[model samples]
Target: MSKLSTYVHVPMENRITVTLLCCASFVCIESLRKNWRPALTHLSNGLRIIESLPMSMLNKLRDTVSIYGSANNTEEELGMDYILRLFATWEVSCALFAENFKPVISVKLYRGRELDDKPLDEFESITQAHRAIVQYTRDIFALVWLFRDHQGDDQFWSQPIPRRQHEILSHRGDCMGGLFERFMAKPQAPPSGTGEHYSLQWLPPTVYPNLIASLGIEGRFKLWAEDPSAAPGRRFSASNRATTSKAAYEMRSAKYPYRSFSMKHNEETRHTYLALLASDGRLMVFENEQPENMSEYTPIDELSICTKPSRGEEVSFKVRFDPNPDPCYNAMQAGVANDSLALVVAGMAAVKIYRSRDVITTSYGVAQTQREFYLALEVGVHRGLVRDVAWAPGNIRGHDIIATACQDGFVRVFRIDTPHSSNEGKSWSTSELPRYENHQVQTCSRAGQLNDKQQHQSGLSASLAKSGSHAERHFSGQLGQVKHACKEIAKLDSHRTPVWRVGFDDDGQILASTGDDGKLVCYRQTPSGDWAKSSELAIVKTRMATP
Candidate 1:
């Protein structure tokens, strides 16, 4: 084996010798167990040599022999099938756990149309278990490649898994799950008459956890189906104006070319807010009446997402409404309320988060809502174009995690820890006015018997004048209130291709991504509080021989 490692780069004409060396190296590595490091080196070298050979030659060799030599088979043909199986095992083993290893041998030897084109049961030559392991691992390798190629693809990750890819991941995951179930459900030993023998439940060994972790690919199909974003967002078209014909609001601005727009609904206020991304790098915010009533939209405030005008025309932006508002905002003048929300915008290679506070200004004899979005955190990783940005749901951790898929083929996660503030425990009271119904406006403490000056000061006059007026609040005011400390918790480049889309699981625990490479990769936070790669799946396309 030691000598074979040195001669791994030998001429390709010596295929038989190379194959024998690879089989021997793999056998030695398994037998030596504790002292397998040197054997592994030999195996890696020999496998690389075999991987470099043409698929045609390997196929010819495989077809000439069976698992056991037949009467018609010559000495050269004996054990060829077993040798190929050894190569396949090594390829999968390297991909799952080995360092800096890829599955070149498997790809070269696979005669199927594509790993994802068939279910495990469709394979005829191998046992069900063997078939599942081989096909799934190879499919995962293809998935990783796809993920790398399409790292910046939004549709791949955010939307429903493509039909072909979906079938592959789903089928493989089911196969693996069944295998585990069968293994655990093995028949128990027959009870002895004399002694009471309990049927012990079968459990996988501890080493299986690491191996089973890769089975996450099986659940990905179900996860994608459960994702809210799996269904495409409602589309609005000006040409076919039946649904959106009645304009909620229109900003006739030739001066500021609106690059993109995002809308977020506040459950507390039951009002929808619109954010228009201006090419000038500023965001224009507008307030709407209610969820059902969308006929009117009033311009509220505008803020900058970027310090300077971005040269790139492509922009991606999303808005998130924080459930908890800073208790400090609850004290802003009686009857006036503040809302906490955040705007994440990306252009070029930069992603900026703006913490916004919608302040209900009750001045000029009318109550109105105004928003102020301040730049809170910025991530300027030298990664290429920022393709997509996702803000995970639920803030149980008392912080926000923003995931970005960049053209440089990295899915980076940033953690923003801000002060923990809530308006849950606080209470508000109402006072009656002569002309209007008793308005229960959100106030700090001043309850009853207010003079005219106090009425205007407490914003009771505006509440009295307007019908169904409420505050749309987001990130509190004071520039320093927003956390500037953005920690990059994870920077994953396993895809090795431009990532186009990123999305979070419901609980914000798992993050999945897809790229132009046609692969999907998932990451999850471990109990140790570190983000690690969980699983991978890919759409493998293969070339057919010309008829």
Candidate 2:
């Protein structure tokens, strides 16, 4: 062969080898990718199947049902309750009250402990055992009973089975009978001295006949049906009204010798009736008559009452009031202001200010225009209280400042001012400054014009300056403390009980508090503006103690 021909042939062979290698690599890559998907999919499916099986099934097959019914009803009348009790009782007697109930398969116990292998023999005959079981079941399933009896043994299974068969048989009938009996009996003794007790029987629904009757008559009342398939029925009048009306009552006994009670009217009732039971058991009824003009009276949806004990079985009344138009007002802190505005913290969203005034009459002059106002604010916190409110210096600018404390331990400041800033510059206009628009200003400066020079002259200037200058100002020149919004700004930690009430002074310098533990704590603002325990005042001790 010639040298040129040999070189040319070698190049051709190299190209063919490179092409073959590429094809083999491509085939291997495709094969691997093809197998990957099925493997991943199979793994995912197996995990899902495993997760779907419940742990309960893995252990044992025990079923539990909760029954509810009237305590007042007889077995026949409480049809379902009666049947469940009967079934449980019958199962227990049949299973446990036998000559060979728990067939002995030898087991060992600790030396100090002793085992009683005595068989139950309470029933005279199988028929009697069945009857006892039925009676017992009726007592436990207090409301109603629902079950399927597959075996025809209901008629004759009461008879004791042959001893030889006991070993091979599943013995479900006997097992069920025994279980029902145990449940019907008192719960295994709870750890000694716990004093906790629970009964299988339930309270009677009939106890609230008045409530049911009210719901039936009032078309608005409806029951909360858990099952959509069940009939949509009207709940007893009381239950429906209780859910929708927003009217409620809470009664607390006044110490050992006194009693106290409070009632709240529902928002639905434009007119409300409140009955206060005093310590001596004397009832005082206050009827808030509906106004001729609905706009004049603020609709009261939620109500609460608080009472304080006085001398000799008489309680001085302190009512925590709320006029809820929305569910937000369901929880509120209430206080009376100088016999005028009834200050209330309604939910976390707003404060409700209510006032009642009498009108003079000429001859048969009928009183008119009992005004009610609701000042809503976005800054309100849930379970927050309008602990204390004060009019700004002079009340000249038609402005009022309010301080609120919340369960979360945050204190919020809200300013109620005339809607028009133009009116603010003018001297206090007594023209009954039309209801002020409640604005939740970011700072006091945004709320109104601040005298910077005067602020600088006074010690208060430092606090106002930290809020920034005019260029950053968004609203009126009012300045607000951002840190004051924290729930713990005015915390009361001295008492172990939850702080129920909180209040702040005009400068936001001092905080007053009361709580379930019946202790009053005073906290003062530190130089840094954080609240600290007041060194000047000793804690005011309350005479009463919580139970």
Best by TM-score: 1
The local distance difference test score of each candidate is 0.54, 0.31
Candidate 1 lDDT by residue in tens digits, 1-547: 4466456786654456656656565657564464556656656666776776667546643332243433554444445555656766766776677665666665554435443354433323324445556555666674665455566677776655544564666676777766645544444422221222111111122211111101011111000001122345322211212143323233434565555555555544556566666555566677765443344666655655554545644544433333232213222211123355566777557787766543344454454443555566668884577877788776656567788888888999988665334542223332211111122242211222222234332345433432221122223444224444578889999789788888888678899999877888999898976789999998775534545
Q: Considering every candidate listed, which one attains the maximal lDDT?
A: 1
Residue 146's lDDT within candidate 2 is 13
Task: Estimate candidate 1's alpha-carbon lDDT, on a 0 to 1 scale.
Answer: 0.54
Worst 10 residues of 1 by lDDT: 217-226
Candidate 2 TM-score versus the reference = 0.25
Error of 1 at 35 (Å): 51
- Model 1 CA deviation exceeding 4 Å by range: 1-257, 307-338, 358-369, 420-484, 542-547
Per-residue lDDT for 460-531 in model 2, tens only? Answer: 332233233323211222211011111223333554543455555444456666655565667665676455
TM-score per candidate, chains pooled? 0.43, 0.25
